[model samples]
Target: MASFVIEGGHRLQGEIHPQGAKNEALQILCAVLLTPEKVTISNIPNIIDVNKLIFILGELGVKVHKIDESTYTFQADDIDLDYLESEKFKKDGSSLRGSIMIVGPLLARFGRGYIPRPGGDKIGRRRLDTHFEGFISLGAKFRYNKEERFYGVEAEQLHGTDMLLDEASVTGTANIIMAAVLAKGTTRIYNAACEPYIQQLSKMINSMGGNISGVGSNLLIIEGVESLGGCEHRVLPDMIEIGSWIGMAAMTKSELTIKDVSWNDLGQIPRVFQKLGINLERKGDDIYIPSQEEYEVQNYIDGSILTVADAPWPGFTPDLLSIVLVIATQAKGSVLIHQKMFESRLFFVDKLIDMGAKVILCDPHRATIIGLNHQSNLKATTMVSPDIRAGISLLIAALSAEGTSTIHNIEQIDRGYQNIVERLQAVGAKIKRVD
Candidate 1:
């Protein structure tokens, strides 16, 4: 295991480029299995989860070649369909949640797909019912192997049908779209997830000869295609990382510029930070945050205390709520953070409270933070990273605290953010990774 020893109270300056979107990379990588032709992808984030997915593809006999540091070409011309039933595959596929997405493309092209019980951050109950249910709706036979804790889907030939998802589950929507693109008839998906990742996946599939309409809306229509061809795709910048940097600049009173942030796709993220009084300037495609002595949280129009909550896309992302909560510790006013999507994600506030932040854990899903208003610095402490988002949030808190802080189990952070220690160091953050 490794840890990050960070010296606090240093202001970071200069420009930092956000890595490619981690979530979108997962979807795009899985989509490669849908086509036999070489699909070149640029801006691939070199992170643990993505690498693990690539490793899984290699195990399945997909041809993967590295074109550059952030580019790769994948061809599924010689896939080993039987490899999905192997014991090694069960172990490898269970390592990341994104591995479950492969079932869609595999079932679409090969008529069968298998997956072990997937593993990821234990934030809350992330259900796979929506995914399997979508496959079932697309004329696939779904079965669960209780002994192996695996899921299997098979169809001689998938016939498209209408499906109204129980929720706008991102992975579920991606899985259904991948499967529907090759079905025999038209597939209509209502209440689908329309996040930037989903939109980009649709565009990439369309470019590869699939017909998908309503790329940026909840209703998606996919016409079955005989086969898809090769295409190049460049993923958008990581919005979660952009939001985290914004929070970091506000908490530490630093002047930082996040480059190539895909500003239009950021939706309400910037406005959400602005409500906390953080100053942001848009320079073409980049976001510049000026140094701040203090920032004040804004109240509602009716004079009630302000509340920041997570919703589906077009609202505040649940992924950045942890960062927002940590940033609020230094703001001038109080705000309630509701993590409506995940129950256990807000429990990390106990550690923040231990570090001198005034936080009331209303429940597993909500927290109310009373800002210090720069009155005092947070005292450093030893802590463990419970999950990816919480781990980065604690790292941010440690950077803005007094004295040195040690965060253990940072492998969780590496699973998402690429070269975090090195990237932060480039901007003058005093952090070191230790074995």
Candidate 2:
């Protein structure tokens, strides 16, 4: 295990580039299995989860070649179908949540897919029913082995049909889209997730000879093709990382410029930070955040306290709520953060409270933060990170605290952010990764 030892009260300054979108990379990487042609991808983030998925592909007999530091070409021409039933696959597939996505493409190409019980952040109940139901709706047989705790889907041939998802689950939608693109006839999906990641996946599939429409909406149309071909695709910048940097700048009173953030695809992220009274300037495609002594929260027009909640795309992302909640600790006013998607994500507020911030955990999903207004700095303390988003949020808090802080279990942060210590060090942050 590794930990980050951070000395507080240092102002970070300079320009930092956001890595490629982690979510999009997961879906796009798995999409390579839909075709035997060579698919080249650029701007792939060098992170643990992504690297694990790429390694899993190699274990499945996919040819993976490194073109450069952030580029790779994948060819799934000779897949090892028998490996899916191996004990090694069960251990590997259970390591990351993204491994579940391989099932869709495998089923489409080889008529069968198998995966062990997937594992990921323990934020809330992340169910796989939506994924299996979508596959079953497409004429696939779904089976679960209770003793082994494994899921398998098989079909002689998949024929497209109309599917109205119970919820617009992002991974669920991506899995179904991959399966539908190779089915016979047409498939229409309603209440589908339309996040930029999903839109990019659809675009990448189209580039590879698949037909899909309604790129940025809840309704999607896919006309199954006989096969897919190779294509090159580039991932968008990571919005979650952008939001985290914005929060870090505000908390530490730093001047930082996040470079080449896909402004068109950020949805409600910028405005959400603005609601917390963070100053942001858009210089072309970049976001420049000026150093701040303090930022105040804005109340509602009707005289109610401001409430920041997470919803589907076009709304505030749940991933950024942790950063928002942490930044709110230093703001001049109070705000309510509602994490509707995951019930237990707000429990980290207890740690912030221990650091002298006023926070009331209303429940598992809601937290009311009364900003300290910089009257006193947060006192440094030792703590453990529960998950990726929460870990980064705590690191931001530590950077703005009065004394040095040690955060254990920083592997969660590394799973999402690439070279975090090195990146922050270049921008004047006094942080080190200790093993």
Candidate 3:
């Protein structure tokens, strides 16, 4: 295992170009199973999760070729669907939650889908009931053996139907969309997750001849198609990464400009940060973060303490709550951090507390952060990362601390951010990756 060692309190000042969306890349990669033609995707981030998905695709006998830097071509012309039941496949497949997405495509094209429980962040109870419910709604029969923790779905003739998802689960919605794209009739999915990642997937599907409407909204209508032909598409820049950089520059009082941020696609992230009193300058498509001595967190209109919460797409992203909470520690006022998505996400605040952050853990999902206003710089400390966002949060917290801060379990960080240390270093952050 590797760890990040950081000598904190260095103000970062530079320009950074966010990488392609990791979430979008993973979802798009699985779409290859829906076609036999060659699909070329550009601007793919070299991250752990994407690599694992590509590895799983290889196990399924999909021909994956690296054309050049940041480009890969996938062809599912010769697939081995039987490998879904292999021990090696199941073990590796269980390592990522995104692996569950393969079920929809596999079942639609191969008549069956099988895999053990998928794994990713241990933030909370990520349920697949919605995924199975969507499949069952599409006339697929599901069998789950709890003792073995394996799931199998089969539908003799998969037909599209109208469904209101039990919940707007990101991956569940994605799985359902993949299944619906190849079904018999038009599928109307209400209350769907139309996050930027999901919208990107929908666009990719549409480019392949699938008819999809209402993208970037909760309502999605998909018209089933007989076959999909491969198409080349470039991925959008990662908004989450851009948000992370915003938080990073805000915390360090650093002057930073992020290029190619796709300002139009950043649905409400800018406004959400504005509520936190973070000033961002948009010149063309670039976002500039001017250096500031201190910024106060704005309370609600009533002057009561504010609360920053997460919701589905067009709402604030739950994935960013961790980073927001950490950034709040340096602001001028107190705020409640409500993480509605996961139960265990707020537990890591204890580590932040140890580094001089004044936080009250309300429960597994909520915390209150009282800002220090840079009055007292946190002392460097050693900590272990809990999840992807939490890991990056801790790293950012470490960078603002006074002395040396060591963070273990960097694999979690690498799973999302591409060359984060290098990028941070480019901006004058004293961070290094060490084993």
TM-score of model 1 vs. true structure: 0.99
- List lDDT for all candidates, in order: 0.95, 0.95, 0.90
Collision count for each candidate, in order: 0, 0, 0
What's each prediction's TM-score? Answer: 0.99, 0.99, 0.98
Once superposed on the true structure, which residue ranges of model 3 sit more than 4 Å away at CA? none
**What is the C-alpha lDDT profile of model 3 across 329-425, one tens digit per residue?**
9889998999988898888898999999999998887899999999987879999998899999999999889999999999999999999988889
lDDT of 3 at 409: 95
Clashes of 3: 0
TM-score, cand. 3: 0.98
Instruction: Supply the TM-score for candidate 2.
Output: 0.99
Instruction: Flag regions of model 2 displaced more than 4 Å.
Output: none
Clashing pairs in 3: none
Task: Tell me model 2's lDDT, rounded to 2 decimals.
Answer: 0.95
lDDT of 2 by residue, 382-409 (tens): 9899999999999999999989999999
lDDT by residue for model 1 (262-338), tens: 99999999999999999999999999999989998989999899899999887789999999999999999999999
